[model samples]
Target: MNTLQHGFQLNYGNTDVMLLFEGQPDHLVPCTSQILLDSDLFLVAGRMVGHSFLHGGPALAGISEAVVDVLFGASPDMTTITVEDCPDLERRQTIQLLDGNKDLSEEEKDAVWKLADMWDLPGVTSDNRKWLFSRLLQHAVLGRTDKQIKQFRRGLKETCIWQLLTERKDVIPLMFPRERDVEIKPQMVLDQILWPLETTNEDEDYPVETRCRIAGYLREFIATASQSSLRGLVQFWTGWEVPSSDMQLEIVQGSLPKASTCFKSLRLPGHYTNFKDFSQDLNACVATCDTGFGLV
Candidate 1:
């Protein structure tokens, strides 16, 4: 907003019209309208008319000179001309002009469409413009099941969601699977069980904390899958501390179908007091699945 102030007032009536000279264009002096009057710099407005002689000046090249000349020529003198120039006007004008032109090929229009979308402009209105941009930026990174990812994608912009599925670039190498990893199968088993907990319908009613717990458990299970060994994965989640022996025994005693043979075989050295206690412990283990010993 800070700009040069005018230095003096000039009379448009007293100014003489001069013929536009073409040679040495760059050095050609700016139009009198370009000169600031009264305070510091030039002003363009209705007062300065018929000065098309200034049109060919090099200073006007690469500018909105044509538009400015057309709009302010008749009133240039009284126009409150500030000295600051808009640097992005030319590029913006080019984009606007490209969108306005209908003669471009479909392919060329697609490119322009992407540019407009990237710049967050309204000009790109092709039926699949938003979808196309999303696919182009897609990267598959997460190793989550397609269903889990579908949920994640639902929360993201349509244009960015496909990358997680199509590209598989979301999975970090450190977390990528390796051969002979028994933990992978077990983690898959855990995920298969936990995935059902994540199901939610738009019309279904549930407490906010329950939803958060489901999401947190799923994310934790996915994170733990990246570890190399069962002990390592369990340790990563359990923080290497042993779970309570009585709680482990109680988990073992629970006749619930949800409890796995693996949970029984690990011979967890603890007793859980009751079914409620066991269920709470199971949820806590998965909830704190990333924490040490699953105590949390």
Candidate 2:
């Protein structure tokens, strides 16, 4: 399941382009790939979703709501489409220009007209320009990708979770949450840490300053870390990119920051006197720790 998750979400370790869905991190909408469609990859994607859910794997969250709505039988008019779901930048830019500006500049009008002609969509009139904008958003997002969506639905049904997915619409948010819904926060990773006994001895007359300083550095790093950095931390501490409930932290006086994936524990060096050294070493370890036995 993790392997499947990596292939879809990370595109088999290549992020420059995708073979299936498109959009920002958590708002993915399927972009039509004729080659992949012919190969039935989307159907396989559907099965991945079902199997992942059943087997307790990745949530595969961030799927665009429009795609989720259609997967669960929403009609064209009923599906909620967002501008982000439009995979084409030019068309999306034109739609954005048309969204609220009824009095478009001549250049903007030309862009929209060009987009309409490009897609064979209805042309814009001064009065109907607003209507055109909405239709363009819908078309760019879902209209052109209808068959791909259907294939995804068919694949999902093959896993027999379609009924539950359709009947319990509330589960949509849980199954395929919005990007913001599942985005990792600094405190989230901090909460996952089981601080060492040395750091916990707050009332002691003499504290384990080495342990506390390194532990504090870890906390500080997480607090200011990028999304990818935190994800790397999770992937390092656990075998997967998701955080676990029982991650332990151990401070060793001379060792570098490393994790025991099977134990969900992070062992950090306790000798660091400054945040820069600590962060640099920690970042180096995280950068190369996503693969097997990756500790340096």
- Report, for all candidates in order, the number of backbone clashes: 49, 0
Q: Number of the top candidate by lDDT?
A: 2
TM-score, prediction 1: 0.19
What tens digits encode model 2's per-residue C-alpha lDDT throughout 1-296?
33333344335353644447776655577767676688788888888888777765567766777777777778878777778777677778888987775577889878888889888877788678777878888888888888888888888889988888777888767767665666789888788788867544655433587677777888899999998888888877876667778889887645578888889888887678899998998888888764545466
- Worst 10 contiguous positions by lDDT, candidate 1: 137-146
lDDT by residue for model 1 (26-80), tens: 2211222322322212223111111211221011221222123213122333323
Task: Please report, as a residue range, the 10-residue window in candidate 2 with the lowest summed lDDT.
Answer: 1-10
Give the whole-model CA lDDT for all candidates, comma-separated: 0.30, 0.76
What does the lDDT read for residue 84 in candidate 2?
78
